[model samples]
Target: MKTASFPSLRVEPKLRQDTESVLYDNESLSQFIESAVRQQVELRKANTEFLARGLASRDNARQTGQYVEAVDVLEKLQNRLDQHKAKHTTK
Candidate 1:
């Protein structure tokens, strides 16, 4: 696949030095920056999805007036966790 290049970033010298210091063996500064950009892109996408789901749930609740109480939800979740743990545990 043909790759396109993004514009270069001009960061402070000290910040650049600190970032370069943490790279693993044989890793380049450009590689580190690219990995960081990729991670931020993934995180932002996840965050946006989370917000959209919450908004949709809110709208559905408003339209239908049906909702689970927080305490009931927490209790159900805790019970499921305990069941899962029991199944996974040895002994």
Candidate 2:
């Protein structure tokens, strides 16, 4: 596949130095920037999907006239969080 290139970016010297300071050994600035861009793309996509699902759930609840109580939802979430914490703490 033909590879495409991103436009050259210019930053303040201090910003460039800060980025370089955190790079893993032998990693290039281009590689680091590409990885960062890819991560942001993935995060944005996940957020979009999450919002879509939430909206769909809201619409479904409104249509069905069967909605969970906030207290019940919070209790379930808290229980799940507690279970997760307990599982990790035992490890």
Which is the leading candidate under lDDT? 2
Best by TM-score: 2
lDDT of 2 by residue, 16-90 (tens): 999999999999999999999999999999999999999999999999999999999999999999999998995
* lDDT of the candidates, in the order given: 0.96, 0.98
For model 1, state the Cα shift of residue 56 in Å.
0.7
Q: Stretches of candidate 1 above 4 Å error? A: 77-91
- Model 1: lowest-lDDT 10 consecutive positions: 3-12
lDDT value, candidate 2, whole model:
0.98
Error of 1 at 68 (Å): 1.3
- The segments of candidate 2 whose C-alpha lies over 4 angstroms from its true place after superposition are none
Over the stretch 1-91, how does candidate 1's per-residue lDDT look in tens digits?
A: 9998889889999999999999999999989989999999999999999999999999999999999899999999999999999999999
List pairs with backbone clashes in candidate 1. none
